[model samples]
Target: MPPKPKKKCCSDKPACKRCPLQMMKKGTLPPGYTVKKRKLVKVKKSDKKSKVAA
Candidate 1:
């Protein structure tokens, strides 16, 4: 398995080591990992969604 990706990106022009964007480009991101708002987020295993109360 590959090294865990960085939780946050340095936002550098060249992308820092373990940067999520860089890992994505390199196709080394682990399962359930995704980049959101320039940060790496792990998808909830429960897949639960907030319910709006009527």
Candidate 2:
């Protein structure tokens, strides 16, 4: 069995205090805080093509 995946801090607000990405960007992460890896989102070419057609 695979190990359990880590929980991601998925806040959309800018400079979210609880978000790991924001904490890492600000260099204010608390001691022993483990940063979770972020998943990459795939963009659909159809959406871009439709926008270009408009």
Candidate 3:
């Protein structure tokens, strides 16, 4: 049997660049395929004080 494709989980991952869902959201995906979606969100700052506790 042929080797299976290496799975990718991020848009920046070369394997996921042309994924169906990414294409669908951009209206470039073709009919009948589905994909898992993930949001690459920004990190939020903490509300704690700058000083550290002993």
Per-candidate local distance difference test: 0.85, 0.49, 0.45
Residue 4 displacement in candidate 1 (angstroms): 1.7
For model 2, how does the per-residue alpha-carbon lDDT over 1-54 read when each residue is reduced to its tens digit?
322222466767663455666655666554445464553223334534344554
Ranking by TM-score: 1, 2, 3
| Per-residue lDDT over 1-54 for candidate 1, one digit per residue giving the tens place of the 0 to 100 score | 577788888888776768999898888889888999989998778867889999
Q: Which candidate has the highest lDDT of all?
A: 1
Q: State the weakest 10-residue window (summed lDDT) of model 1.
A: 9-18
lDDT of 1 at 32: 89
- Which candidate number maximizes TM-score? 1
After superposing candidate 2 on the true structure, give the runs of residues whose Cα lies further than 4 Å from its correct spot.
1-7, 11-15, 39-54
Q: Give model 3's TM-score versus the native structure.
A: 0.31
Candidate 1's C-alpha runs over 4 A off are 45-54
- What is the lDDT ranking, best to worst? 1, 2, 3
